[model samples]
Target: MRPIDEGMPRERTLLSWRRTVLAFSIASFALARLALAESLTLAESLAATALLVIVLIVVISMRLYRGSMSAVGVSTFIVSATTFLLGVIEILLVLKD
Candidate 1:
């Protein structure tokens, strides 16, 4: 295959990754912003903290963009897992209250 053909697939994949990052960043920021205004119980406070961590991860991801795709994918997974944990924390807080 030509050099241009090889780069085309990688370029498309990178574009898709950028879109995913943008979506995740927007969603995470909105969630964190809304969570900030809530009156908190201990669990809720921790959940808010986790949400903030995800926001931080998003910021760090931008800095590391030129590094490695593997590292970026790992960070994405961590943020996603943290998001899941935050959901669980919110659910428990609801049950506790």
Candidate 2:
């Protein structure tokens, strides 16, 4: 068996978190564009943009901290779940109209 590199797991975890953040950012931008093109009011758009910014900031912080991979995992799940729900809601709204 090959000797394990102690830092490899942490490096992989951090890279996974970065990829999660990138995916979430893409999804958020798509949703925002859909909202702006469809039925979102200016106030609603601003609020959503603010929330996305805050979430992104937190995720980035978790990635940079290096204290705990748990924090990164949890934040990644939160962002992914939130984006999925928002996408579903937006689709429903679009279909309803």
Candidate 3:
């Protein structure tokens, strides 16, 4: 792989992944807390499950692609798109309430 400016690009990429994981962690905990407080509707429960699955996918992909920049980038893109989709699902849940 071509090195770029003393690994700044790599650092940024890792940081982005860290941010995504942290955000997903927060969302997962929130969902868990909500689930404990009251019964969630089918849609909400599905959303929570999907969110968890996406989190696992992201974590696994990141680990698997640690040595490959292009592979990690593709995984990041997929994870990002799914995260946005989850956000939309959350919005719908709020609207339905």
Candidate 4:
């Protein structure tokens, strides 16, 4: 049987991860739009790659969250941080015009 309070924290964490995914999706869409407007092939490719990485991170994060593994949670946080950094880089590159 699951503890009563456990669900609350887990649910909150999951919601935060979902928000992260949504934010990344919006950023990726904006980057794509900017890339298309300026004919930036490299920016487009980098943004796509970052978006894919974010998707992969979200998948791993879901698994980690479900399993309640602290070790994997740390790894997920690291992956999310790196993915965010990559997304920032993509945005910067796209705006470097």
Candidate 5:
């Protein structure tokens, strides 16, 4: 068995964490606006759900990134995909409403 490249993996993991933090921050701000709209609708609920899923994905990615034997790249991809999905859903919900 071989040991992992400690420094590189840590750097990549740190980048993933930074990205997740930024994505979550943006989504949180957007969610506030969606929640405070004139009427409560299904669109708002869907947007909220998307944001929640993004947050969960980010948290899970970070956890997986920190593990020694796990692959960090895949986790990063998952995080990015979820973030994109969150944004798309938010847009769709807002437009639909």
Candidate 6:
């Protein structure tokens, strides 16, 4: 059993993270606008705020995750999972409203 090449895999992972973060940020902003336009309830507004915060955190994490081996995977997983969860929640909220 041979270990995989470290550099290429890491680079690909980083690029994927970058694309995910960009998509999350853009989707959050779009949802925020939709929520604002539709006069969302306080709870919904708070959810949007949470999504925005997650976007910011993910963006920042990308920078910090670049070279730190120990923390990179943790940050990437958190961002990716949160992004998917938030997207689902947003869709449900919009439909519920």
Best by lDDT: 4
lDDT, candidate 4, residue 17? 78
lDDT of each: 0.59, 0.63, 0.63, 0.70, 0.65, 0.66
Prediction 5 global C-alpha lDDT: 0.65
Every model's TM-score? 0.48, 0.59, 0.55, 0.63, 0.48, 0.55
Best by TM-score: 4
Model 1 stretches with alpha carbons more than 4 Å out: 39-76, 86-97
Taking the tens digit of each residue's C-alpha lDDT, what string does model 1 give over 1-97?
A: 5574565765565566567656655655554555555644543555456556646664555556444435766676776786686567556645765
RMSD for each of the candidates = 4.8, 4.3, 4.7, 3.7, 5.1, 5.4
State the lDDT at 83 in candidate 5. Answer: 66
Residue 41 CA displacement from its true place in model 3, Å = 7.4
Q: Compare candidates 2 and 5 on lDDT and give the better one.
A: 5
Error of 4 at 36 (Å): 2.0
- Candidate 6 has a TM-score of 0.55
Q: Which parts of model 5 are misplaced by more than 4 Å?
A: 1-16, 36-67
Clashing pairs in 2: none
Evaluate model 5: give its TM-score.
Answer: 0.48
What candidate 2 gets wrong by more than 4 Å, as runs, is: 1-7, 40-65, 68-77
Deviation from native of the Cα of residue 79 in model 6, angstroms: 2.2
Between candidates 2 and 6, the one scoring higher on TM-score is 2
Residues 6-46 of candidate 3: C-alpha lDDT, one tens digit per residue: 75765576677667677776775565555443455654665
Model 3 lDDT-worst window of ten: 31-40
Per-residue lDDT of candidate 4, residues 1-97 (tens digit): 8787765887787788788778767776776676676667856785777677677767766876787555665666666686677677666765786
Give a tens-digit lDDT track for model 6, residues 1-97: 6566656776676677677666766776666666666666744774566676666665665566565445666665777677776688678767888
List the pairs of residues colliding in candidate 3.
none
